[model samples]
Target: MTVTDDPVRQQASREATRWLILLQEESDDPEISAEFDAWLAAASVNREAWAQTEKAMGLVARLSPGNTSSWCDSTGGGVDMLRQPRRRIPKRAAWTGSVVALAACVALFFTAPSLLLRLRADAMTGTAETRVLHMADGSEVTLAPGSAVSINNKDGRRSVTLLAGEALFSVVHDPAHPFVVKTGNFTTTDIGTVFDVRRTESGVDVAVRSGRVQVSGGSILAQGRELGAGGGLTASVAGFHADERSAEQVGVWADGLLVANDEPLGQVVARLKPYLSGMVIVPSHLSSQRVSGVYSLTDPGRALEAVVQARQGSVHRYSRWLTILR
Candidate 1:
């Protein structure tokens, strides 16, 4: 029988939903023990519900703490967090399915089912909107203005396909499944870590923060390269290589922080483009000039001002955009 239609399974689903809300509340307020006690007393099913939810949620926690929504099991089968929605619980075989599901859930539940920890995202961001996403793996992703991405959770892997613009990924570590990120011409994989990928006019730019990543030209090219901690790479149709500063620059948006450690003035302007209100253009003469230091993304104008003062560069504001000249 379908889980929603079965009496016992229906009860479990209802109880699980209630516990989800309770767990979120408890996460926010840890001093609710007495409240929890009262909740448990409200129904004997409350405890059972809590137990089942705990099992499911725990599975998610073990697998990936970010995508908890995928663990709903309506068929009364013991809960196992999955990357996709559970198949409909068959009606005639309810008893058998529940037994088998429970057994499988227990085996899979030990490590947190990979289901609830992966996300399926298909979205587009407009010119004015900046999109922020929390992945199932406890990593955060921020899309630049006017960007789009598609996230897929498959049986063996978690993948993100960036359709346009730039994206930052801070991935949580899971040895069982590797996280893969794809852009127009590039594909990057991570066991667990953070990085940024941007599509530039000429080619793709990749920057790394924590952990390591392997970048291969996706479908566009024949080969890919690996990137280690603090490594950055820039590639076009022509080629790819190791870059030290670019990787660090890509992560600037993750914490609302910005930094340019001895990087070109032009490069810094390119990195700052997303945070500022208008275009930031550095003159060709200063394009190769190196700049260094940390700035706040919250105040790009101040950061711009600092760059001008320290580097003897002049700033010109025209409408919403700004231009810099040495």
Candidate 2:
């Protein structure tokens, strides 16, 4: 059953997933396997939870390594980790080099867009991190946290592909070579303008801060649409949506400010996540909640409280590295 179907089973599933992760990480140590067996023998529900958790974690194996039914024979399905060998985790230790960073199943949230971005992005930023890159075509790109991009300035070709997250571009107005930014299905070409392109869960958002831009895509773009300053367009494969937004409101995140205007709470948390030195967990239910606010990107904890509390939710910081919104 899903988490919504049974809360008791949900707790078991969560614990099982945690045990699986720990065993995979410390498989060489026998103590972990013994502890896991003890937990499993303590209750029959634990075995069911383990099986369900393993099935769920199977997806992680596709994205990452060392995830398999053979992670151990702890479940009598693979090599016995207790007999073969897992470590004593120090209290309050860092969760470094674990699946906690880019988990695939927990709450069904993926921090980064895709594993491909990790290998392909010429420039990328980690949690709550931002990067500024000067392209070979005299253009500048500001990448938001949890963002990645591949720059193609070779042979004097001014092209950039935003692999993930959001970016603000400042073009040098090189008519000889039109600066282009591509993300998903949308291609935004600078017509002597500065603009912002953000990749969201639904579509790609292109907004001009100054000058104009010619956006061309599939038939959805209506034959190469053009947007001027204060104009914004959100284009997806199915269609596009156009809106008017002030330049100051377009890419204010570059200045450590986030002005959410009826945006989803999930998107806001995704934006601020890069700034905080931790993870923010927003269940799928609360993710759809609409929110509007002006918060400091520099102070994500306070901002997170403001955003979650406004929606009648509470922020619980389990540690410096993890926060859950409920």
Candidate 3:
């Protein structure tokens, strides 16, 4: 059981753990899905607990011994088809077959989540690659590498969900047809503008490059926040905060550079993930350390080393397949 200070949170965490196991063993069942969804919708705390459980599971897989291939079920059943993904599966398909590769395969799935992302996203980009997708409604979107989005145009309105990474959106102004970008708990409705939306581990970030945007969500954004050119805001679970940046500085990652201005070390590493070939293991303490610097996305390996080194941390590259940030 997860013994948290709050009793509500503790119970939610325990239920979330149970749901996670059920998902692995019988995820294909529609009844199981409905039950899980109902449980998740029962309370806000349940959603938070589920998110934490998933995060914890990912960490466990990443740090697990590569040679050891144990999982929840000893029979090695559950989610086998999606174990290896194309873009993130580092050129090592010839490893010892099936059972023995379970640990590494599961780790890759948890980290990159290629299968789920593919199923959910209509358009996506691979490592070290960005894509410019032109919407049917004359809007333009520049997807950051390792990013994916699902676009919908219906009922005279346009909707796009940022499934992973970040994206720069240039919407065509049409009051008759609204353009909205949704990520996590927030929905950024473009009031005729170019903007950047990034889905971080903690929450969603909204930045306007030109024109204006209307951000709406729960809590701080319950009343909606309007941002004009050069305006920025970060809405995290911890709370909402103002993080303003110049128009010129927003969406710089599309230009193949990671411009970190008082950003967390983990955020910096996350931005560079698309260009990196494999997984990066960043310690919690080191990841939370504040960092500020401009790093090159074209040469992500060196950039990662620089980010970690600035905090007196070391980067250990066991192989191109894994890089550990201490």
Models 1 onward score TM values of 0.54, 0.65, 0.67
List runs of model 3 lying over 4 Å from the truth.
Answer: 1-112
Q: Which candidate is the best by TM-score?
A: 3
Q: At residue 57, what lDDT does model 2 achieve?
A: 44
Clashing residue pairs in candidate 3 are none
Task: Choose 1 or 2, whichever is better by TM-score.
Answer: 2
In Å, residue 127's CA in model 3 sits off its true spot by 2.1
lDDT of 3: 0.77
In candidate 3 the C-alpha lDDT for residue 47 amounts to 85
Candidate 2 vs candidate 3: the lDDT winner is: 3
- Per-candidate clashes come to 12, 11, 0
Ranking by TM-score: 3, 2, 1
The residue-by-residue lDDT of candidate 1 on 220-320, one tens digit each, is 44666777767888877677667775545556665677677787878877766655654455778777878888887666666676766677766544323
What is the per-residue lDDT of model 3 for residues 166-202, given as tens digits with 9 covering 90 to 100? 8999999889778989998889999999999988887
Q: What is the Å distance of residue 213 in model 1 from its true position?
A: 1.5
Ranked candidates, highest lDDT first: 3, 2, 1
